[model samples]
Target: MATTAQPVAAREAVFVARALCKTYRMGEVDVAALRDVNLMLHEREFVVLLGPSGSGKSTLLNILGGLDVATSGALHYRDHDLVAADDAALTLYRRQHVGFVFQFYNLLPSLTAYENVALIAEIAHDPMPPAEALARVGLEARSGHFPSQMSGGEQQRVAIARAIAKRPDVLLCDEPTGALDAATGVRVLDVLETVNRELGTTTLVITHNADIARMAHRSLHMADGRIARELVNSERVPALALSW
Candidate 1:
């Protein structure tokens, strides 16, 4: 992917969603998860999505990462139409291009850190060595440790290494620090910031913590399944400096 800042047009954006809609039907009623959502994520940019519970932040992230299809309107990954993609196409797109980290560490309990990360690298089209990826998150010494043997922050860092081992074009993180304490959460955020800055990966992070917004280039606020507002930081505060 081009690291230099090019003009981000609709066709040129890493991800684009225009008038996107998603609704889930229960036995008798339908719940609208997203409503005419419009969004664009530029290549190599770090953006944070802030919202209350059930504000559709996770839904939007899932759609952007090809993990779920939109109900209606245009959702594009570069020139490809995500809304029109079949399950196979979406799977292919996710496997080949996107990296994901979620709230839980989700590491394989039976595997050591190295093995857990190496599993993805083995299948990636272009992958950094698993060891190198681990080291990127400051986990070189913990390569032999299993998730159960590490602290919460360490496990989260290992999970991050596994996600980025594929050297994906985009990293979609949903509440990556939600499971950790404040100090540990800052550590995870630091690793995320490092990945974005060093590897030039476009990152979209979803978090309920409003204080986390200061670390992002642009903060998007979601409410009732729509993006209610956006705030750009004049100067991004380091994760360690965050009050929360």
Candidate 2:
């Protein structure tokens, strides 16, 4: 069965960042995580943020997901200004618009895959049924299994299912495959690609692996907390097509 495409525009900006800066204080020392970052993420775009450790890729994702507030910058997600948002507004924004996947699966060990996914749907405003979400990640048959009963790749797929089940407008993934071996990592990435293509979630993946950049519609390289370069892939490769 063919999947429908995501709409290109939604009559408003999905993300807008200007002169964004993020700084952290460790005792008397200050660390600049992001500096003078400017970016615009649109609906349904599959973007990859690539950089080494301390390059600020994860910081950018956190700021976008509303998990962390920028120290100095202007960020607008649709009509909501993230910099000006209160804790309650940020919570609602995260609940209603953002879905997150981290390097760790973070699934409950005792809950079956279906139950783990259902937990998110239960709290979501308008979520897809748990079984349907599992099917989307090619995990329907594994729904009955617990996290310990599944392979790392399978567990990550379940995580992906849980994130997408909320029908979020933006999906933020930080080193999503970082814990898996290369082979398993590829499988997890395949699921993420499928989610982006099939569901049209505006997906942003943060990775240090340059190989994964080929799978993105657009790739942004970060350095010293700023976007060093941005490239549009004329021919994007699906994750399944990647070797290594």
Candidate 3:
């Protein structure tokens, strides 16, 4: 029964949305992906959007991460108006402030872990060294290893390292552990939790697993293209304590 209560001075909100709507145009039909959604993501908070498949969780995450734009509504990332931003602005916003991790590892087949992370750092406004990023994810010794040589969890860790090397303000993870088993997924979640704790990145995770909600500072449930309810975990548990 945890409420959304915390230290007012330190709890700064990052993304705020009101009456958000997103629609997709088919060949001859319009499909509503998200409908009048409202949400707020706070600084340094670990939040979870939990929902069944096709419940608009991914759509909402994409919009927040700037991968997609809402059809209509007020969506703001701090002072930036996300709903009014152009393509160039959105691209720049993502590069400078947001980092993303997906279910699939999506690592470059031909590159080693170090190289994959360094490629992003090369283009970032300000970035940490690839080796340092690797170390943060506990993969320093495997920096030289190629993606094909790594396990699923190791590959996901590498992906997390690449995402955080640029030191983004927000980290958006879309089912980051979907491809791993329980043990492997826990390792990946451990890395994510560590990053949120040590770096103060506002983190949002999209998942169907209810057990994972126990690890979040606040869990928002989505249903039928809208936010159903939210629960704040005043005393959050570790990922290792969760079961399928």
Q: What order do you get sorting by TM-score, best first?
A: 3, 1, 2
What is candidate 3's lDDT per residue for 34-71, written digit by digit as tens? 99998888889899889988889999999999999999
Off by over 4 Å in 2: 1-12
In lDDT terms, how accurate is model 3? 0.92
Over the stretch 91-148, how does candidate 2's per-residue lDDT look in tens digits? 9999999999999999999999999999999999999999999999899999999999
lDDT of each: 0.90, 0.90, 0.92
Per-model TM-score versus the true fold: 0.95, 0.94, 0.96
Query: Which of candidates 1 and 2 is the stronger one according to TM-score?
Result: 1
1 against 3, candidate with superior lDDT: 3
- lDDT per residue for candidate 1 within 114-174, as digits (tens), equals 9999999999998999999999999999999999999999999999999999999899999
Candidate 2 lDDT (Cα, whole model)?
A: 0.90
Backbone collision tally, model 2: 0
TM-score-best of 1 and 3: 3
* Residue pairs in candidate 1 whose N, alpha carbon or C atoms collide under 3 angstroms: none
Q: Model 3 Cα displacement at 62 (Å)? A: 0.7
Number of clashes in every candidate structure? 0, 0, 0
Give the top-scoring candidate (lDDT): 3
